[model samples]
Target: MVAIIKTGHSIRAMLNYNENKIKQGKAECIGQGNFPVDADRLTYIMKLNRLEKQCKLNENVKRNTVHISLNFDPSEASLPKEKLLEIAGSYMEKIGFGDQPYLIYKHNDAGHPHIHITTINVQENGKRIVMHNIGKDKSEPARKEIEQAFNLVKAEHQKKKEFKPEPVSVRVQYGKTETKNAIENGLNFVVNNYKFTSLPELNAVLKLYNIEADKGNENSRVAKHSGLLYHALNGKGTRVGVPIKASRFHDKPTLKKLEKKFVANEIKRQTDKSRIKNAIDNVLLRNNIIILPQLVKQLKKEGIDTVLRQNAKGLVYGATFVDHKTKSVFNGSGIGKEYSAKELRDKCGANLEKLKGEFQKAYSRDDLLNMIKEDRGLLSIDDITKIVDLLSKTESTFDYLNKDFLKQRRRKRHRRGN
Candidate 1:
């Protein structure tokens, strides 16, 4: 079991969040604590008023509301609702919020089975419960005890297990699922899990699952208002359906929310920069002469997706890398100059120059062509093209020494004499 505790200022906001989930059929209010009526019989206003009344006792407590989610492993998904409520009650008591007016919501949105608990730290006597380091001081010990008592999978054990993002299992195939649900699921997976700083970087990750976040053109009303929309992309990457407004989603992933995330991810993705840089450097190091396509193939093998940005003239001007292993996205220039598109092209060009020098010093044009023809399997098309280019640079010398050129010249002389 893993317990995450969050504190905010609005109890109504937290209640409404869970209530909205219930209305969407993604969650249900299954249990309550310190309430006069049973959990099922309690109305939305009843739940809100009960918590609000205690909150009103301490007007000084700004951060009075507490929202906790007790997440269980997938193996324990079959655990009955009564058992889940029991676990929530115990967890709250251990964390010192058991006696407070709270509601337990069984959320069916995520892959694992988890329940959300909404409560307040403020008590009836206008005194606030101590909320300092509550997770480390109280919740940690509580989680371990609950794990052992319920014979549930340990959080440490679950940590050792590899986490596959939910989006990997299913992609948004147009016309298959509701557009809103598809976009929501894709956004939930990427927005919460991936560390992306810019909108383009975020799109690099989103495009993998056939979803895109757009703010319209610069001159458009949506862009002028800083509004954003998410659209489903067809297999060819064209927008296929009506765009869903960002605000329409539950988490409200609006432009403002994403801008905040951009700032936070900028700081979060710094430690991960070296991982991507090293991956690119290692690929270049191993293959002394590699083009962009080969470099992309090698990085994909290392669990990184390289997205090359090109202009209308087909010139690659930018590069973005998505590292699946780390769940981090980085622009090439963000990592360093050498990883940028221009610098990368220069590096590949430099390798070709080196190969040209080696071939010039080692073999003549005819000898190089003979070598290539004799060992065609050993060379890539790029290698053969490079050799052909070298031959072209010395075409006069090649013709002077060629048997085919001599035969053609002699035949032309004979025809003229005739």
Candidate 2:
């Protein structure tokens, strides 16, 4: 089972979306709670709205509406309706919203059966349930428990079979083309699925599908002025068309929205630190692994993005891994000394400079042999001498590349010549 949560300002919009599905004969009301009157669509929305107005909360509390969906694997089709409801209720209880008034709608509009949940996040006392790291901190653990108790397929296993959003399909916004719809869906997918620490790390996953949440420059008028601009990006990081204000996006993935996510993701990803360490171990265990880019490309398939932190002189000083699956950021040192940025060159048996650009990662012995076919064949005695020179320079990669020292030397040489 997989759970996705969204908090918004309006309960009416969510109630209507599910109610409209019922009107279309595509969905049916399964269960509801905390309504003053009968739990029909009308009373449901009225009671929730009355409660929100009664609380008299300010607009700053953006999570007044809680919209979530629980998706089940197609293989679990034979599960009884009673167990499904139990699971839903159990999940809600574990996620810290069980006591709150909520409505459940099971939709058969798609090939597989799934359910939508709607509830106001504000309590009777007018306090909002904390939304920070709700997904990783709460949902993931609850999901594992539910999956075990219900005997369902694991989500991690399902992820391998799922198709991620494509770049071109997600970026185009012509003539009410699914651009708007796609962005909303894609944002939900990325937020719920990938564990990202910071905005740029999150954007790396978002931009893959041509979507970006640009906060503008720190000194720029947009940042000084305050607000977020979400725009479509091309295959390049450039904007494809007009940008949408953060407020304009339905889910409102504003800086505040994402900051909450980042903090949550940081905590959530820690539980899966071992998973990342295992991935690094798997790649390094390969006998022919020879470059950083090759390892980086392979790690992407595992839903891990490797960021090589470099200085102004183009020397790598650190490495951070954005584990999208876990939604965590880890420094190379944080994981282990062996996996640190400085350790990678020695670990891969490649000089730092030679590892730049692109390199082919070898998966098999034959593949490894084929990769070096373009190389100058096997190394002779002369090649050995050159290899030693590279290794000596590789140990102190910053040599002759320090900008300050290089500038001083140039000035000194000019004065002496004059």
Candidate 3:
């Protein structure tokens, strides 16, 4: 089994996430630990009140929430819910949370069978639990002991299994899933996982999953009241479904809450900014000139996604980079001047005339046609169109020049200038 533990300040958010999954038919509340009522009999208010009441005991403990997921190998998908609850109960007892009130949820969304446990770290005596390195010092040993005691597949052995679990949150497909549930899933994943400093940065990450958080126009009543709405976007990036008010979600991802997140994320995402800048620099260094589309493609290969913002007139006005590796989002101007939309567009356009000259000198019409035939599978639609246009008019050539040859020529020109 693989165990993952996370601590947060909001017990409501953790509960809402799992409960929302239940509403979507992707998970179920199997059991509750240290609670008076059974899991099936408990209401949402009962769950939240229990955790919040304990959390209120110690106002000083900010990170009082504990959310844990116990993941099993795909081979154990048939594990009975009762057996899963038993394992969860034993795991909690071994880790010192046996007496704490925790709600256990068995989620069916991933390939592997897993259960999420939500609890608070505060005791009834208004004292905080020592959670420092709790996973390494307590959970790891408990996991090993449980694996041996239950005769289950060991964590080390499960690593060699061919099956890999899919992500819990996937891109929202229009009309495929419930609108509120899909948006909530995207919001839960992005809000918890990614460090985005502003609304646009958050939207950049959310856009990957076809979700957006919108605050109405400046003079609108919603904006005046600091209201926020989440909408599902179609394939064309236009909002299609009814916009759900932020307050409608259990977690209450309101403008006020997001402002607090923006402040925290600004500090958290700082160390990661340099890594994104370096990735962009590396891509720029490899080519004399690169359009936004090519730059976006190359960055994706490095596990970074670029979202370019454009106006109604189709002018590139901004750029935001979402680095999946680091879980960080950075606006172009936030990184440096060179990475800004205007500067990048200028750099891409600077050598276009020179690039066309190089292409013409490098390949003839017959050579271009043969090259296209040979690399058709490797070429993008834009590349094919450029090559076709070049064949029709000798004066117009594509930007498909040899990069190595261009680099060599650049060096020679530099030497001559010196």
**lDDT of candidate 2 over 196-293, digit per residue (tens):** 77777677667666788888879876566456776776654567676666665556677776788788877777787898899988886763435555
User: By TM-score, highest first, what's the ranking?
Assistant: 1, 3, 2
- On lDDT, the leading prediction is 3
**Residue 120 in candidate 3, Cα distance off native in Å:** 4.9
lDDT of each: 0.79, 0.68, 0.80
Best-fitting candidate, measured by TM-score?
A: 1
Q: What lDDT score goes with residue 181 in model 1?
A: 68
**lDDT of candidate 1 over 1-418, digit per residue (tens):** 8787878887777888889889888899998999999998999999988999888988999988898888788888899998998899889889888789889999887677889999999987789999999989999999999999988999977741233334422345454334566567678668877899889999998888778899988998778878798888876566875787776665667787789989998898889999999998899888766656667778999989987776654456788999987889999988998788889866765665675555544466676667466644333455567767877776454434559878898999999999
**Predicted structure 2: lDDT:** 0.68
lDDT by residue (1-418, candidate 3, tens digit) is 9888878888878888899789889999999998889999999999999999988989999989998999888788998988888899999999999989999999987556889999999999998889999889999999999998877899888842223322213354444445566676568668877898888999998888777889988997778878798878776677875678887775678788888989999999899999999998999888765555667779999989988876654457788999987889999999998889889866655543344556676457786687477644334455556667657776444345578987999999999999
Winner on TM-score between 2 and 3 is 3
State every prediction's TM-score relative to the real structure.
0.72, 0.57, 0.70
Give the clashing pairs for model 3: none
Off by over 4 Å in 1: 6-13, 58-65, 127-137, 159-165, 168-178, 216-227, 348-418
